[model samples]
Target: MSFEFEKELRVTETNIPGLLVFDLPVHGDNRGWFKENWQRAKMTALGLPDFGPVQNNISFNATKGVTRGIHAEPWDKYISIAAGSIFGAWVDLRPGESFGQVFTTRLDPSRAIYVPRGVGNSFQALEDGTVYTYLVNAHWSLEQKRTYTFVNLADPELDIRWPIPLEESERSEADLHHPMLRDAKPMAPKRTLVTGCNGQLGRAIRQYAEAHGLEGFEYTDIDEFDFSDPNAYDKYDWSLYGTIINAAEYSTELCDDTDNADKAWRVNAQGPALLARVAAEHHIVLVHVSSDAAYGMNKESKTIAPVSLYGQTKAAGDIAVANAPEHYVLRFDAETLQDSEQCAKEVFRLLDEHTAYGIRDFS
Candidate 1:
């Protein structure tokens, strides 16, 4: 195996302190092959601190439309493709600093992306034979991890040239002609909020909105708010805002442990409940972000199945929000915001097949 960073995934600067990337070698013959995807000793040799992984996740996708990530948490992760291949992308989502900047790489059986805590990770399968796996130092927390949709991650002007060319199809045509790719736009203004933040999607939303000026919204981490106290709402004046985005969570742990289950429910379910109520009472639009995990392990189902404890709790939160007339519940899985060029290219591709050949509209 050979190791090289994807030309697009380089970091200009980061407060993350340290990030290490290594290429694990593969030994193959006519009979079969062997590769050491992760070796703690090897990582340590490469100068990475030996904080071992606590959780391992494997995701398999079929067909090119099978996009599964933009997944991340506050914990450090060692990510590699065990079976097939994928175009892995990483973006720093930590607030009060440089955010929305990306480092992308083609993670095949040959390469990997080492994502530290506070950075966002997502990927698309270059082909059908793709199995994306990751090792997380922190275990699953329904409240801790967050998901965003694909549209949120496209940045046209960023010009992230993948090692492989993206397939063109009607669905992705508009993205191909996005203005940012042709003529990038100035970075959007960052927004600042004081309460109910810190989860993955929340951080992404905060960073994305600030970077793109989509809605002129800003977010603050949990440290900035004391939602545990009912009186917390009384301290902030809410009249100036047009929308309230709630991404805060109390737990992300998913297991049979009753304590873990209860905590996940309380934080993921109850916390959002309180925030939605406040937003409703204040007459602000509550954009309560949610996840597909609520559907459980039945990936085969056409719809989500809330099976696990985490799923059950998130489902409960979904139900609560559904009951709230003033709230707009947005359910997303693996989201990103791309620059204009990528956006335009995607758009152009989508419309090209429908229009007459040799005639350019340019409108």
Candidate 2:
């Protein structure tokens, strides 16, 4: 698809399939300079994942010629130099074409690189106090076993030519003692992610899990994981969960707005559909919690006539789940609760423990 990017941005596709360099336009005036670092809409238009970042990391170098990394993981990365400069390099480690070929670039604070999965990445600072920041798309859970595959920067077999001599560079103890990529094994996911913890179904699931002594489940709320971002729900090891319970929904009246309608489709429809496809691919069971909104003013179970955009999106989500090879959609009413006593007990438990507590006046 042909598209026009923002004037301030230039996406340069590298020789590597998924690697791309973003040259940001810096506006310099009499005072200072400014640049738009990241925009999901723009990134998506340019064929990049449009998900909210799962993790943000920063690495600071105290001296020039200090090298860190040649590390590879199971997820994609957005790396940008925030201060000073570095001779950054990324090597394709995916078994097959371009297995050991390296891509080298001189990175300053203004430029950023998109590193796809299965790439060994490294950098050597050219200036003291150089800062590097990376945005990753994986939900990190240390409890599950994970092995970080690494390659020696000066490996003769890989023939990765460094800009400066290795004798002149300082390396970390871990880097000096790491194993080769070919000998490494992939990491396993630790737990199933239960998103939308603040919602009714999510809270019920967490309470049930805690009461039953069930473990290996990660609880997250809307604040932690935004479902609308296309890249928000990927890179998790599907083998971790037999069944993924999706209790999240966007049921606000704001869906009536034309601008907000797209968000509803993204969250309630496309997001769930993608999740279902992933689950089916790995033979994981997906128990998707849907809404009565899917029924709307339809005549029977098969026919659907959505009265509102919210209902339309919910119906779309249901259809998405139905298309999956192994999926179960549970339609329910969110307005009524079956466990008022249990909720009250939990609320009272909170009130008794805290000195400063919030008591809302419910009319």
Candidate 3:
């Protein structure tokens, strides 16, 4: 199937003005199809959003480059590879920002990269067919988005350097003359909040944050806050946070026991509803983690499929959270062990026992 990819930029530069929309038409045939690489008039007519590009250009790479980018400046770009493959990466040089982070993804003929404004980015061609295209939010006047060769590793103020030489060309040579390289400025920090801190998943998230050296996060676990309690929303400060990872849930194992269904509904369904409602009211990005058991009984009911009350209630919970606008639900399965033996070990043990006792045959 063919798809159309487009984007509207919302920024202003010294060389370009107003909203700009960039779109590419993708066509498909028996041996694959073609697309309009870039059209200036079509974009202008589409009423480009905010920032528009004044010039368009393309690059061809013959080999993988050494010492590629982990760099950024006060510019934004939309990049796509028309052919070949490369490992594209970006580092938040936005300085002091909370998610001033590093992200990397592979760019092939199938994928594109949207490097945000002010983020440093670079890539290395993996094959001979590599063609890189970029749309800058600003026009190329004196050549922008350039950085000092050793600013990150040399300057006592910034101390930046490249372990190897950059892949240089006429385009890069022109950018070396920009003024931003002479006086670099630091960026402000960002803050994030995490919800559902006390549950097993919450604890794991906390552990990951600590391991990754993430700071400025306000953690709210079950011990500190209870979603089941109606008044739980009043005690906390909601304005300081922007993201909420909802790891709260009712354990599904209870479905195996013959208990009142109302209790299950309250915890599995109503609890998440309350949290999501509060998140929407506060404008927080809620990440709701769910379970795959919600898919219900499959053909292999005795094995891979879940045929229990827990699965049904979890499915209901999934629907509830999805209805909330500011909520994101992620469903997955997990296994845990109380002793040295895990669930896999127990499954194997039971299988071996069944075979030994003639309950099943290995052959």
- Give each prediction's root-mean-square deviation over alpha carbons: 20.9, 15.3, 16.2
Tens-place lDDT per residue, model 3, 1-363, is: 124333232222211121122334456657875665544465434543223444455778766552244455334466767877666655455443322344555655445555544565566666665788887654443323232121231223323333223433212433343223235444322235555566555666666667667665567755677665678878855443445666666676665675757666766777677777766554445566666677665524522344567777777777777655555555555434222123223332332343110011211
State each candidate's clash count. Answer: 55, 0, 21
Better of 2 and 3 by TM-score: 2
Q: What value of lDDT does candidate 2 attain over all alpha carbons? A: 0.67
Candidate 2 off by > 4 Å: 1-8, 143-145, 181-317, 320-363
- Would you estimate the TM-scores of all the predictions? 0.41, 0.54, 0.41
lDDT of 1 at 199: 58
Where is model 1 more than 4 Å wrong at Cα? 1-17, 146-151, 162-363
The Cα error of candidate 3 at residue 151, in Å, is: 21
Candidate 1 worst ten-residue window by lDDT: 354-363
Screening candidate 2 with a backbone cut-off below 3 angstroms (N, C-alpha, C), the clashing residue pairs are none
Candidate with the greatest TM-score versus the true structure: 2
Ranking by TM-score: 2, 1, 3
Predicted candidate 2 versus true structure: per-residue lDDT over 1-363, tens digit per residue: 111223457688877777888876656556755667666788767766443466888899988899977887755688887677888888777654667777888887567888876677899988889888889766555622254567878776666667777778999788886666565433322245666667765787787668766556677765676555656656456544545667676665668787888778877887788777766664445566666667776536646566778888988888887766556665654453244335424433432343111111110
Pick the winner on lDDT between candidates 2 and 3: 2
